[model samples]
Target: MLLTEEAMKTAIILKMLSALEYDVFDPSEVIPEFTADVGIKKGEKVDYAIRVGGRISILIECKAPNAPLDLKHASQLYRYFSVTDAKFAVLTNGYDWEFYTDLDEPNRMDRRPFLTFNLTDIDTTSASELSRFRKSVYDVGAILSTARRLKYISALKTRLKEEFDNPSDEFVAFFGRQIYDGMFTANVRQEFAPLVKRSVSEVIRDRVNARLKSALLQNTTEAPEEDIDLEEKSEIETTEDEWDGFRIAVAIAARVIDPSRVVIRDQRSYCGVLVDNNNRRPLLRMYFNSPTTRYLGLFDGEVEEKVAVKAPVDLYRYADRICATAEKYKSAT
Candidate 1:
């Protein structure tokens, strides 16, 4: 069954809050749509108002899938935040929820989130951070610190990306000093500069690949085991095993890199996994009943397509084979 983007976002949010629900508070009390009027002389509905001790503690505004989350979209929420007793305001389109509080200054919300994670993107850390948002375990100080760190971390990443894309000579020299302690001559700097740039790219690519892998694994594990064929439970199980094989491909990628960089596509008749965040660019494709695994090229921007692999399970065995590959790469270098 195809999951709509809205459904996907809802599922992701629920998953993030899973641990919090059991350990933090009474999940039933965390109502989805609790209304409030700040006596603004007109009626406007907010998506949610988290109530505790018979008082509204938080307000939320949800948007539809893929909607741009900007300040304009947050106008109503901002207004509600000021007029009501709700100390926190949230804006989300399901996939990305940005949490705000009066951290920098009272009556003014901070631009960054206290916690942010996509439903399609979560790690153990993301899950743990999300747990703090549960009404039962609301700790203002803890959330504030987490938000501050995330805000700065995001800013630092943005700066780094910008610098990488437009590296000034001074920036290069500053990094050069840190790496070699002013030992390198101009010739050496020139030679080593490309290496530094390449390493930076590899780091980003590996991270992206790792994230995709993690998402694929989560998707595979959560997928229900439904019996599609009437006569053969065994056949259905076999099909499931093929999915397990697809998962194994992701598991292999996870061990190799950031785990988020691997993604899978399973469209009934065809199932495949991509090694990087290449947008349906399959690193390998598996024909359910076919006996081969395809070797799609690692791209060079353009000239994109896929090649075939003859052994699906064998490539799946790459999970088991990764350590040796890593060792070989290390030894070669």
Candidate 2:
């Protein structure tokens, strides 16, 4: 098939929808384009739509690969959204997709997308978010709640990254007032800006070192005592979520290998799901370092697949990959 926008939708987007277990439809066989009761003068046909429980749940608007899927591009989608009872609208360019919901006002689509997914790079976290759009587990209320949470979190993280890279005057002043007791002089503000940046860098470095030390210590016994004593020895604090992630990994691996061969090794930087008590033979690495984000690292030879996640169940997103990985290391399994 030619590499046109419509072809890309069939080649990539349609296949993805099928995999997600959505009952997808082309407008021709289904009822034609959805027209808004307001907005546009003439009714228009949507590129495609998906049904859950025999009702239109999502409207998908497809664009060419090079086209940007933004508010301007989604103007028609917003019009269609305003007229329908469908809770979600999707804009895609075969490579990237943006998901929108009417969170700010009823029947009015929010300008900010709740979640975005890339067809070329599907992370476990994004997969989990997409799962909510499935026919078997479509819950309007639950998805809306999660969308609201992620939308704000994404916005906050964007602002934080900007401040972290180049601290704004307001950003410096807000933090300076909390730390300094005396008058907030310009010199003090200037001094503390660098201090704040240095402190953040140090904290990140220390955390990385702590995890590396923990992993190395657990993997070997010949390391010098002085090296181990460089940092204070503290008990590993494993969260319920991490343990749940371990169990999910084990269960997925058990499909191809023996469950008994899988073991959970908790460390400072990441939790290792090892096979046959061998650190060299790692199945998955759980890096739930930040409260806001999680990462599952899986390797295939020289390539490492890092999947972002939000919960334990999200680990299942890579179940097939996990099983295939375990099978490759079948000697240890």
Candidate 3:
């Protein structure tokens, strides 16, 4: 059974920290309550405080496992973390851990956490980062430096993901004015939004494919499990329309998923857009196999139903179904 209360949630976090080799202590020794000012409340208690070199280095507050992790409700963390010499503060609910630092100003905590990790879903990179907080390797300066680097990187990835999914007027107009003739107008901005998104996705995928070819000792993008003997079989030629149709399917599905991670594979029978370059993670299979009557092979569980498409835009007519199929693959990743 899952813990749904604060007390058990704290136990889970302490166990994780212990496994990570952190010397944990109860609130009595750390003293969660503090006298900040004359009028304000005192004797407030934070859950656990991890110390290093006889000083607080990491302050943690735990909530129920099922509770939403938000900084607005963690105002106490923001306050307790202020006067302490600790460089890091954490808000967690056993499963979801949010790490915060004082990046904007000295002593005052930032409104948002620099990093968040799910106990069940943490990546190796995150695990390595969390390792820095261990009792054996605790370093305040090093941890703060890592926090600063990760804070900016996390922010950048978020901004780029947002733009990749839906290009803003400014983002579209930036590319529009360079290639387009005459004055840049609202009409032009409206015209290039979808075009910009498609063009960017195409460029990103092409670059990734090129890098994959270079990085994998010249191995094909097709993973070995697909058992595709592209070596004996000649490379399939992809026409302009097929490429555009792939981009069209990409754009249509981008609304419901992360379009940037979608990989395009030009195969002998069709052009496939997959999740994370896995053949099994199929989003849509374009059989522009017949130029006159193109068919879109959409997956429904084990069954793949082919729908005839006249043009790239025609695929938008099946956007709901297309996105729904992509969702399954995305969820798997």
Give the winner by TM-score: 2
lDDT of 2 at 181: 100
TM-score of every prediction relative to native: 0.50, 0.59, 0.57
lDDT tens per residue, model 1, 1-333: 214645633543333333233211344445555445554436566766666566666777777765778867667776777677777787877556677787677876777665555433444344455546655667767777777787677667667887677665666767787778557777767866777777778888999999889876865644333333545433333355445455444434443344445555544445545544343334444556544444432232344334454434344323333323322323221
Q: Write the per-residue lDDT of candidate 2 for residues 156-261, one digit (tens) a residue.
A: 8778878887787788889889989999889889988987777767877899999889867765753222232324336567777787677667645655566667
Q: What is the lDDT of residue 79 in candidate 3?
A: 76
Off by over 4 Å in 3: 1-3, 6-12, 24-43, 119-125, 211-333
Measured on C-alpha atoms, candidate 1 has an lDDT of: 0.55
> Local distance difference test, per candidate?
0.55, 0.71, 0.70
- Error of model 1, residue 140, in angstroms: 2.4
Report clashes for each candidate as comma-separated counts: 24, 2, 0
Summed over model 2, clashes come to 2
Rank by TM-score, descending? 2, 3, 1
The predictions' CA RMSDs to the true structure, in order, are 14.9, 11.2, 15.2
Query: Hey, what RMSD does candidate 2 come out at?
Result: 11.2
What does candidate 3's lDDT look like per residue over 3-59, in tens digits? 466545444654555444554454433434333443224666567676667777777
Error of 2 at 261 (Å): 16
